[model samples]
Target: MDLGGNRRGVDMGPYAVRASGLYGMLKDLGHSVTDGGNIPVPVPEEIGVGA
Candidate 1:
């Protein structure tokens, strides 16, 4: 996972994954695929540390 981004909505990594066609490409190469969807992100407050 990323360190997250500077701005809100910068965490849109799942969209990037689909746009990059990672799942489809992997499946075409004979991989067993399933879209497991996204992981939950922590709220900034919960981090309790930052740069």
Candidate 2:
């Protein structure tokens, strides 16, 4: 979710976390996994000056 810095694919954070098996692990531990889905993100061009 970081911007204005290194372009190391920070936008893929959610995918990476999911791919890490976190949800599966939690479910294996008998916990319910509720995926709230991705957050709303503004494209870089949508940022205003000094924002």
Candidate 3:
């Protein structure tokens, strides 16, 4: 949901959280970990962010 702003790399927040072992940590605590996967975001060119 981070689009059209001064925040670069904010779009990678989900990936970063997943890479930080969020699923593993949750599973370790005896919780079901079902990854829904990343949401699709439009490219800059697609939405004309800075172009």
**Top model number, TM-score:** 3
What is the descending lDDT order? 2, 3, 1
What lDDT would each prediction earn against the true structure?
0.77, 0.84, 0.81
Return the TM-score for each candidate structure. 0.46, 0.50, 0.52
What tens-digit string does per-residue lDDT give for candidate 3 at 1-51?
576768888878878878899889999999998888877877766776555
Which 10 consecutive positions of candidate 2 have the poorest summed lDDT? Answer: 1-10
> How close to the true structure is residue 49 of candidate 1, measured as C-alpha lDDT?
64
Per-residue lDDT of 1-51 in model 2, one digit per residue for the tens? 666758788878779879999989999999999878888868879899899
Clash count in backbone of candidate 1: 0
Write candidate 1's Cα lDDT for 1-51 as tens digits.
355556666567778888999989999999998887777767667777653
Clashing pairs in 2: none
Model 2 clashing-pair count: 0
Q: Give the runs in model 2 whose Cα sits over 4 Å from its true position.
A: 3-12, 44-51
The candidate scoring highest on lDDT is 2
| TM-score of candidate 1 against the unseen true structure | 0.46
